[model samples]
Target: MAHAGTVSKHPEGFEDYVKRAKLSMPPEELQGELDYWRSRKVLQRMLDGGLITPDEFHKIDELNRKTFSPKLARLMA
Candidate 1:
């Protein structure tokens, strides 16, 4: 079930989270937000062009949210 770009099967522990947090500073978080918004634009285009269903778009959006972990994204979107 693992794909090339997929997350690892092993669960991340607290230390992992802390290390990741340290690495992903505010700048990285901002970049993640920017990336999320850019993706939303593409996703919107796909939906508008009838390339993807609304349900499918939403599913991708949810995945993007999890992938980016953008703050305030849930509130805004």
Candidate 2:
């Protein structure tokens, strides 16, 4: 028999690490980080499933960097 929804392996203290990190972030920043991670996962799945070529992935990533760089620099300043 196999267990369902079981995580067999993770780094030690991973949950605690994530909890502390999340607690340290402002709500808006946390939400933005979460959204970014979710989007990356979806993009990876699309790449893996042959839905998008590696060249296309790189192009999209480059476009994202170009699009966001100004906003990110403004936020950093």
- TM-score, prediction 2: 0.50
For model 1, what is the alpha-carbon lDDT of residue 46?
Answer: 97
The parts of candidate 1 lying over 4 Å away from their true place are: 1-25
User: lDDT score, residue 3, model 2?
Assistant: 35
Q: Residues 11-36, candidate 1, lDDT per residue (tens digit)? A: 32323433544444455565565566
Model 2 lDDT per residue over 4-72, tens place? 333333334434534654456444444343433434556668999999998987777556445433222
What range of 10 consecutive residues in model 2 has the weakest lDDT sum? 68-77
lDDT accuracy of residue 64 in candidate 1? 95
Any runs in candidate 2 off by more than 4 Å, and if so which? 1-23, 62-77
How many residue pairs clash per model? Answer: 0, 0
